[model samples]
Target chain A: MAAQTLLLKGVTKIFNKGTQDEKRALDGIDLAVAEGDFITIIGSNGAGKSTLLNVIAGTYAPDEGQIAVGNQDVTKSPDYSMAHHIARVFQNPTMGTAGGMSIEENLCLAELRGKRRGLSWGVTRARRRRYREVLKVLDLGLEDRLKQAVSLLSGGQRQSLTLLMATLSLPKLLLLDEHTAALDPRTAEKVSHLTNTIVSQNKLTTLMVTHNMNQALCHGNRMIMLHQGRIQMDVQAEEKQKLTVSELIDKFGETLKDETLLSCEPAGAP
Target chain B: MVILSVLPITLQQGLAYALVALGIALTFRVLAFPDLTVDGSFPLGGAVAARLIVEGVDPSLAVAAAVLAGFLAGCLTGVLNTRLKINSLLAGILMMTILYSVNLRIMGRANIQLLFRPTIFTFMENMEVVRYVPVIIFFFIVTVIAKALTDVFLHTEYGMALRATGDNETMIRALGVNTDNATVFGLGMSNALVALSGALVAQDQGFSDVGMGIGMIVAGLASIIIGEAMIKPRTVFRLTLAAVIGSIIYRFIISMGLRLGLAPTDLKMATGFMVILALGIPALKGAREGKIHLRGV
Candidate 1:
């Protein structure tokens, strides 16, 4: 067995604790992700998929849990400090890059992720050449428009650039929160393909959240289904390969059905 | 050019206040922080410099101290906003209020006169030149250096993080940069420049009055608006140049208004109106267009 890349023990997050509107977003999630695992997460609305990623990324501190990234006790590490080990891509294309900055400038900022920033020139001649090489792999012709502002790029192009930047640093863990949900179907397909290539090429441990059951099944070596705040079904390798979309949806639909029935009625009240 | 020598003292004043405009540009545009601390820090600089100069300290040393004081004031405002969770505008207002009393205590009175004392403006006195020539040259040199330094700093690695902090803070923070510290640093640098200009202006006018910095922040905003109207600021170089160019043009307009018999007391209101017009027109037009689109829908 491979060493675990990220280990989560009894992670729980409660919004508005003790208030009448209090809700448990994540309920004691105990997950251990092994090295080079690409896991796809799918669940009903408000199922705590994103909450899990946020907890792992340190965007939201878990109310009760221990999050260890690479053997380090990082339960209290803040997002900015935790960035050295993790990088994330969001659903919104604009969230990953600065619109006002040029492509080269944005890439330069990304290249220094987890690195000390000092008074040296940000984008030097040599660094620009390296960036040109890094950008050429996208086949988006972005290398030719190094000075163009990111605001001018199309949504698909920006998302592509963002994906490149997120993976540029080769972080220990990459979190994608519905990264392709905002793009057009065609652009989403292209970006999905790119995501797979980048993940496999770098051997990066990744956790991706998606609404599409087909996407959840088609990609990732492993898959996990969340209901309420707990992992309902987790299929890996041989078990995951045999599981069809229909089976996955049937299991997912039953959970939704249970939730609606559970909410709409008081069992044995009548 | 001899035109600088032949021009009225308004040009020299414009050159001196150009530093204030640069500071405003750094805080307001680059850092996207609307710092009202300049109003207090400007006088803070003047008071510190004036008092130190009177105590027989080297004029240059006094000016440096003033700049340092302004930097600290700016940092306090940053801390209030980032650490204490105070609103940026309110933090600035609080710092400005505190600085008012601090400046008063530093001066020990309402004003300090450097009329008979040797100052930076008098450094070129030994050189034979046209009247007001030395002052204009000194201010022009300082403004240019300040502009150049700002441009260079913005292109550096640390500057890139600072610019990113203002543009998309979450993105930068995700890249392992502590945004709160960046905000504090940017505020400090901005106020330091404002204070530098304040110190020089006091020496030039031969008196540092407690009220000298009133409405100064608004004036800087007006200068930036006027300058941005002339040229699009796409790069850091053009952005800094825009502030300098804007300051000169703004001064010329103010000088022309004074020549046309406008009351000096009314100048602040006039500047306020200019800024409103400059900022409002584009926004109003956009809103009107948005309404038109809604009607079309």
Candidate 2:
């Protein structure tokens, strides 16, 4: 009976409206996430998993819907205004951090998120110590190389740092859009483990989109399968624990007998 | 001794142009946009500052007003590109076209002479110091201050977001950074710096001409390309310093070329050729590498 941390009611998004190629990215959809909920989203291509995250992050305006984050109506909020409440880690590791800047500079930026920025002194000793402490927890040895350019880090390290940055401000909602899809298997695994640790430690409300069905089922407390821009199956902690990828596929196959569905098994699905 | 005496003047002019190069670097390098508005904005600053000074305004106040004017010009270009959805290159061209007349209107003619008027540099005359010495010192001080300010600004949270916006707009927007606002702000700041340089240059040269800004973007690009070739600094501070050094080297090259009997009218052609050479050399090297790989295959 905890209050919902995020509420989306009757959300709909249409692209190229009134054109020959008009398409509905999201149909009328409603969803609510309670505090401390970690929800995993799985969908085939063009199923609106990314679009939903985009809408919640204020990148895309919903044609019709109301989005509320902790009692604040943020449906029409501009992207800059939403920084105070939301943070996102993009799929590409390079997209989240500035490669031209040093690791410490990037960390300084994340540390000051949602705060008024001005021409001030560069990173101070106290701030550097804080960044070192935060980076040390990753156990990636990045703490020792704070002055290194972020571009020099491996993909996994960059994504892990991005996750740390996203959670730095403890936003009301954290959006992850296939955040590990671009990393190699070993690196992705490490980043995923770090993500789970951080999300649980912070008790954050999060929605993660994934192409890997096993990851969707194994990582979060809740799993939702999206089809044609709508949620087809939703399972909670116990149910999600019990559900297997094969069973989920069978359920999807039962509803939609398309050959494409049978061939779309996620490569990482066990 | 002749070269030695002219060396400082050339170096001083180069330092002044470094501010121009830094401004262009913000728009062209950081933002990755071909902003032609710098051409108009550069002279616009000089015209506004010169006219204000003639009207008895304080030199500092005139320079500030000139910077503001340049910022507005850049904002106009940004609005055309972002809100009106005009192509970025075209948006800059449109603004440049409009500002030509606007600059003339500001000065009430095609040019203004600051020869007899008291300028900001005149304050140094009150002290018993060598003429070129204080001027050179002033140039160095202003350039260093501007470069330091740029470094500090780019290190902040907002600056990181601004840099990220240029790398990938969609991802920046997804991260709750307003790409449009960043674009507008970045362009405004870039051109403001360029205009400030123009204001200072006008006073230094004793006149402002409507055509002074023509081909400025090309010259600035040359300085940047040359600088990047020499000093490859990954940090903002290093990058700004490289730009300043690059401007000096560019001026030195031009001065050397003139000293070697190159016609003044061919300066634009030489600048254009330098840019082409700078842009082409890397690609040519890359193509050679690809060919080598292909041969090995």
Candidate 3:
């Protein structure tokens, strides 16, 4: 078996614990992802898909559990500190970058991820050349507009840039929280394609949470279905390849029998 | 004739307070922190400098000490917000209140007079004995240097991180920046600039009054808003330049108001109105364009 890049044991995250509106967003979620494993997660609203990602990314600390990233226990690590091992692309493309800053500045920020940022110039001549090469891959002609503010970019372009930033450091685990959900269909397809190519080229260990059934079935080496904070199905390799999108949809339909599943808002919220 | 005579003094005041404008921009625009600490730290700087100078400390050293004190005052606000989890606005307000007492204690009185005693300006005068550096020229040079430093720092790697914190906290945090450090450090730098300005202004005016810092934040914000209105700055270099130029023009406007028989005591109220006008006009324009609607209108 490949080395484990991430291990979560009895990871439980409760929102508003012990109050009238207490929510067990993530109830004892146990997951282990091997190195270079691309695991796509699909679940209905409030199924803890985003919450689980947040827990692993250290955005929200698991109330009762442990998370080990490549042998380093990170249950207590704050999100900023966890950037050393984890990089993330948010559902909102604007969330992934500083909109007022320039394109090259954003790329420079990603290049220095998990490193000490000192008093040196953020963009050097050599780094600029490297950034140009990287931007050329996005094919958005961003290399020429390196000094333009990121706010000028469309949602899809921003998401694409965010994806590049996320994978730039080749983090131990990359978390995608519906990264392409805000994009138009065509743009979403482009960004999704770029995500797959980048993940495979780098052999990254990625956990992507998506509401799209085809996205789950068509990408990744393993697939997991979450229902009401519990994993209802886990399929991998040959099993994942043989599973059809309709089968996954049926599984989702079976879990939708409960009505209380739609109320949690911004789960794992602080 | 009255307006023309007020020009030189307005220019001097403009240069002196330019640092305050830059400091506010650093916290509010760059770090996205609405730090009311300027109202406190400004006098805190003057008080520290005045007290130290009275004790026969070197003028430059006194200014440096005042800057250091201002930095610590700002860091105190940062700690309250970042570590203690207090709301940022409340944190600044608390620190501003606390500094009032601290400033009073440092001066041993409500005000101090430094009239014929030595100051950095005197030090410059001594240099002028050899090369003729006019006090006005000295103030201009000091503001220019400070503006250059601000522009340079914003382009630096750590500076970018701080700016990003203001622009988007989550994005910078996810890139491994400890945003708490960014905020605390940014506030320190911001207030340090304000303090430096306060120290210099107290020396030039020859007195550091306890009430000197009142409404200073609003003044700084007005300067920034006016500066941006004068020139829509898109780059860091232009942005810092805008603050400096904005302060000069703000001072000019105030001088014009004083010339028009405006009561000096009513300056703060006039400034308050100016800020409202500057901030409200854009929204009003948007409303007129049908982008927004006012129910009462």
| DockQ of every candidate | 0.78, 0.39, 0.80
Cα RMSD over interface residues, candidate 3:
0.6
Error of 3 at A257 (Å): 6.5
After superposition, the stretches of candidate 2 with alpha carbons farther than 4 Å from their true spots are A254-270, B123-130, B168-175, B288-297
B1-297 in candidate 2: lDDT tens per residue?
A: 556656876888999989998988788767777799989999999999999999999999999999999998998898999999999999999999999999999999989999889999888777797777788889999999988888778766677777766655655565556678888999999999999999999999999999999999889988887787787756667678878998999998888888878899999999999988766765687764422110001
Instruction: Name the regions of candidate 1 deviating beyond 4 angstroms.
Output: A257-270, B1-6, B286-297
Model 3 off-target regions past 4 Å?
A257-270, B1-4, B123-133, B285-297
Interface root-mean-square deviation of model 2 in angstroms is 2.9
Q: How does model 2 score on DockQ?
A: 0.39
Query: Residues B95-201, candidate 3, lDDT per residue (tens digit)?
Result: 99999998999999999999878988776656635322366788898999999988888989999998899889888888899999999999999999999999988
- Each candidate: fraction of true contacts kept? 0.87, 0.35, 0.90
Task: Give the better candidate number (1 or 2) by TM-score.
Answer: 1
What does candidate 3 score on TM?
0.94
What would the per-residue lDDT of candidate 1 be over residues B1-297, giving only the tens digit for each residue?
A: 433432566679788999999998898888888899999999999999999999999999999999999999999999999999999999999999999999999999999999999898776766787647777878889999999999999999999999999889888988999999999999999999999988999998899999999999989988887787776688888888888888888988887787778899899999999877766765687764432110001
Candidate No. with top DockQ: 3
